[model samples]
Target chain A: MTLYERLGGEPAFQAAVDDFYRRMLTDERVSRFFDNVDMDGQIAKQKAFLTYVTGGPAAYTGKDMRKAHEHLWSKGLGDEHVDVVIEHLGATLIDLGAKAEDVAEVAELAESVRKDVLGR
Target chain B: MNPDRTARPAEPSSAIHLKGRTIPLAAGESVLEGLERAGIEAPSGCRAGTCCKCMLQGEDPPAMSQRSLRPTLRAQGFFLACQAYPIGTLELSSGEAPEPIDTVIQSVEAVAPDVARILLRPEDSFAFRPGQYLDVLHPSGALRSYSIASLPSDQVLELHVRRIANGLVSSWIHEQNEGQRVQIRGPFGQCFHVADDEQKRLLLVGAGTGLAPLLGIARDALEQGHKGSIKLVHGGLQPDRLYMRPQLSELAETWPNLEVEHCVLREATEQEHEGPLDQVAIRLAGSLENTRAFLCGDAEIVRLLQRSLFLAGISSAEMFADPFSPASP
Candidate 1:
């Protein structure tokens, strides 16, 4: 089974997304990117990101990620912000009861798009 | 764009009808591509469902097109035009800006020091959900958005206009007299009440004139025979900022399932609860499970309430928010 199914699939994601978003919003290191953004749209994108990282069925592509984050690149989106996101992703998965190894797997998956996210 | 309408069966052949124009779709062509082929300007990005910029309301849209949207939007027949591949004739709606409707001011009364309760009678058939907002056009081309406070049964549009200091559209609206005609466009916004589950608890929280939309949703839910416990929390900077107390109290008294609470930041009266608005709302709400929350008012405060409520256990899907961007003076 994929890590998504192992981690409880779609039913488990609603609360996970909420928890993950709260962490991101409260984290001072990365909160600036989120200010004044459309809440619903951001939430939807975050959910899609979660699904992508967790190996759930999503239509996320590298081209899409690069295009999505292009506007934020000028606002100082870089490796540090990507690292913070990875940290939060790991923490959110750990909080949701994923095994350490499973989290590493998700992190590796999330890391694959780092170049695209930074628009490199 | 009412989702409550009975859905029609999809036709065997595929075509898209938009704004009085019908464009036949090539086999396997997406709705966005078809619209573009017909020289129509439909907003789109990513050419995929991820961006959600190409959302359109339709009759029985393909299920795949709505998979990424929120439940409320999905219920409202909203789908991404980029991802839709309708097998039958699809009628897209509200793509173009609606023409302004001429309405006569029926009455205007001051509900608070800076707020006016303006009632208007539209000369045209304006079909809109209660909590949606419409743009009131000023004579000089300036316009402002106000939430509808009255239900369809009232046969008139009720708007609560908070007069911003030196605000162009607001100042003009406050000075208008009865019998004066005004132009209005759109009944837009998705923050209205939906009777998905009758037993689900409802929380309506707003600050300042944000109370307008919450009041509309509360009454709409009650009118729809919702059996759920409904809580309406209205907050302000001080006691005087809270308006329409007697009407709210009368509503709560008439409906046993309804509860009304007034909150203020400072100078609380004996009848009012004094504290931070978000804290007060979460405290009074008690349990958050199976609860649907509607939050409105200042953009910053709405964001705070949305985050707090989501962390406190309400699902993101169940929370509907209408954050008003501050008007530049």
Candidate 2:
């Protein structure tokens, strides 16, 4: 089974997505990127990102990731911002009762997209 | 296990009706796949139901397709195309305006400095929830939306319209007479109260004329005998902007479970609390657990309230909103 299914699929991801988004919105380190954004639309994007990192079926491509973050580059998005997201992904999974090994795997998967997300 | 052969008749195969074309669904094929097979470009993402990007409205769609959406969206016939497996032919919602209904103005009274309470009686039978909004079609073809402030049992449609400085539709509505005829359509929106849990506390916050839908919802809940506490906080630029104080005060007196509070940004009267709306509302809400919030008024302030309340502990699913944006010329 894919890690997505092993970790409880859609319902489990629903719970994790809200927690993950709350953390990002509340965290001063990365909250600036979300100003003037619609809450529902941002939540949907977060859910898609969570699905991609957890090895679920996602329509996102590396090119899409680069384009999505392209505008944020001028606002000082870089490796540090990517690291903050990765850290939050791991923390969210751990809080949701994910095994340590699974959280590590998810973090590794998230890191693989760092270059694309930061337009490196 | 014995297979039942004579207990039930064979059901009809499922098909999709879209834009005057009928497309049959192959066995095990989803509605999205069927649309794609028929050379139609349907918006979709993450073909698995998690993304919720392929939502479409349908008549009597499968319950399973709407499971992940909120109750209000589901009630509006929205379903995820990727998850739908309709057991019967389903008619899709084309992006066309519904037919307008003719109504006669029953009354029009100025409730505040710029707000008018206009009542209308539809010539034909009309069905709508109290908090849902409808479009008023101006004689010049401009359309504007207003939320229903009166329950259906009142036998008339009530709207609280705040006249914008140079708004065409609002100006026309404010100048209408009691016997005048008007055209309206819709009853759109998903901001009404659902009677799912009688014991769930309701926190309704509105600014300026946003009190229309909240008043409808509060009345609907109380009429349904909601046992949980309901707190309504109405805010404005100043105390003069807050209308219907006497009516709301009498309502609070009638229902022990309902408590009404008025707030303003400045010039606090003895009866009004003064501060930023979001801060005042969060402080008055006290405990946020098990609370469902209905936020209304301008888009920016509604967004602020939504984020603040969500952060204060209300679940995203428990919050409904109607954020009005200015009608573009």
Candidate 3:
């Protein structure tokens, strides 16, 4: 089976994405970056991005990561913020019963975009 | 707009042209840092130039920091990007890098008492050069690199693994079952024959499983219609330890230009040479002029031969060595 199928596909990704945002929003260190953003649209874009990156069958039509996060630099997004998001994402994946290897894989994929997410 | 406005001097911006894109470099920044800043993902390991993973061809002469590169590679303008700083506008080329692939073991057998010859069938897209090495990710989460012993035409990857006592990865590899999936990451290193000329003589020396890559190199040279003589010396502590003697003898019979010799340290036989393999090879080879030499196996032997060959008038450009190291804990 494809990694997407093994990951439980759309339903699994949605639950993990929801939990990721929940944890991120409550974390004081990274919450300020999303203070003035539209949460619903942000969540939808993030979900599509994660789905596509994690081998799921979804097309992410939103702006590429660098462009999407360029405006966040002025809002104090940095390496620490990216680290927090990755930590939350990893935690959410584990909480959703993903295999440890799969969780590590997803975390590595997210970390690969550190420069883009920090607008470096 | 005032027509009399004096044009400001062009800002000094050093840059590198790589992959058809211009990446500006900051003062005191290495080429690798500039490429990373431009979002170009260059393959890197150890990032200090020791691993040679970030090697790239450039238009400029190699930087002083690139003195560790092979003389041939440096002469060809290949430099480690991690250590090189842009002098001016430079054009760098990094051809399509090979990606890691999943492979399944086809078979594994002990060709020698201590040596296991493993055959693997990689996914259809996986490809590698003959003398390159690959990193095997073991089920125990340890990674160990092994050289490829098979020719490209074989359609399967072959590895000669010397069983290391108490080694995590090597022991696991010896215990692995047929059809087990393995994650392989590379085809790395630059030790293959380039066939620069048809009459270029080759001297290959190997010890233990180091013979694996040398064997691949010899077969590749012969297959490519190399017209010059190919001499191979396999060294071991005992006569019975010269594992591939029969196969090599068969190969010698088929390829008239190829000569195979086995050298043992403590035993003497009319068919084999006595003493150290490197010493025996030097005696047999006579002069080192104009011959390409490849040395592999024990680190001490490789070092001794490397120094000996260099002093005997062999250019550093014509010598290639792969010093063997045991798998890390």
Candidate 4:
């Protein structure tokens, strides 16, 4: 089995992300980040992203991390945002029923992107 | 030509065409150097041969300049599209290493606490066998490697990753968001799957993060209707250390051949068995019973299993193992 298969490919990850962002949209820690954002486009990008990140065959051809969140840096996003992202993502996994190791893999990925996502 | 002014000696030269420009490439110069010298962009990550982002296929298959390119991959036509320069007037194309792909891409999404999944979508017509890995790049230009967790058939590429404490790239992802981008290159490594070998009973063994590849193989098998006995042994230090129990349980319920077992060596510490994993090989001798086994985990565990299994009369040819680099390294 490949990583994509393990992550349950499109359907499973899509569910995870859908549940993930739904929680994130209202998340007090980072809800402001989603204020003006397009959930549809964000979801679309995230679907492609989570698919690729979880070992599926997709590519994320989007903005660079620094440029994407230079605004957040100016707004003072920190490890709190990182924690919020991870926490909500874990909840998303639970909602979608992602496995522990799978969630662990996601958590690892979260940590990898934390610095840039947090804009530190 | 300015020998006295240069600290390093220049080697032989080859001609290359990039973005419609031809430049002289030194014999030892990599495709990356060739492009860099010509002032054209060439994709690369983990120039160390471990990352497959610079993968290319053309008149000549790319060759890994370093032995780090896994053996199964080298047998297939993988070369560090970055490491190799044109030996001839080579037309070049590339896929991510481990697998295969084109272009460079990255966007951030937090998939789990401590795990922010960085998406590396490939360009059109990416080439890769299922189950290869890739290396992710950071704004600071550091490199971290990961595996493609998605099926090879999809247009987009996916990966599953875990965080290393204070890891350069992992830390970056956890803080990033939907539109945020980072450098991504690859589809490196050997395929963990063989085309639905129905005659071969399939046994998947994973330890800790090692389960990533096994997940890929199992999904491929189930989707294809491969009718082999599937038994997965995923052991952690303690039961709580195990992840994916629910998912595995669900899959087992659906597949008659699939049975998942969890083992714990101790209870207090979070560290899972990188495995003495020798126990797996011994366990396999009792259970493998002529089955083809796919093994992935720490190097020590993998090796220990191989030695024990071979002696236990399971033919060495029947065993497939993917060994990970040390955690501290």
Which candidate leads the pack in TM-score?
Answer: 2
- What is the C-alpha lDDT profile of model 3 across B1-329, one tens digit per residue? 76456565454467898667777788988888888888888876546444456778888744664665555466457888888876777788656655668899999888888888899888756666677788888766688888888987898899998888887787778888899988888877766777777797899988888888898989988999999999998888887777867788999999999999888898778878999776788888876767999888867777667656644555545778777776556
Q: Estimate candidate 1's alpha-carbon lDDT, on a 0 to 1 scale.
A: 0.89
Residue B169 lDDT, candidate 4, scale 0-100? 66
Q: What clash pairs does model 1 have? A: none
Off by over 4 Å in 3: A1-120, B1-99
Docking class of 4: incorrect
lDDT of 1 by residue, B43-99 (tens): 886565655778899999999998867777887899999999998799988656889
User: Which stretches of model 1 miss by more than 4 angstroms?
Assistant: A1-15, A26-36, A55-81, A91-102, A115-120, B1-12, B19-54, B62-64, B82-87
Ranking by lDDT: 2, 1, 3, 4
Better of 1 and 4 by DockQ: 1
Better of 2 and 3 by TM-score: 2
TM-score of chain A of each: 0.96, 0.94, 0.85, 0.80
Q: C-alpha displacement of B292 in model 3, angstroms?
A: 1.0
Q: Considering DockQ, where higher is better, how would the candidates rank from best to worst? A: 2, 1, 4, 3
Ranking by TM-score: 2, 1, 3, 4
Per-residue lDDT of B131 in model 2: 85
What DockQ does each candidate score versus the true complex, computed on alpha carbons?
0.33, 0.63, 0.01, 0.01
Residue A57 of model 1 has an lDDT of 63
Off by over 4 Å in 2: B1-11, B17-24
Better of 1 and 4 by TM-score: 1
Candidate 2 residues B192-284, lDDT tens each?
A: 988889999999999988999999999999998999999999999999999999999999999999999999999999999999898899999
Q: Best candidate, DockQ-wise?
A: 2
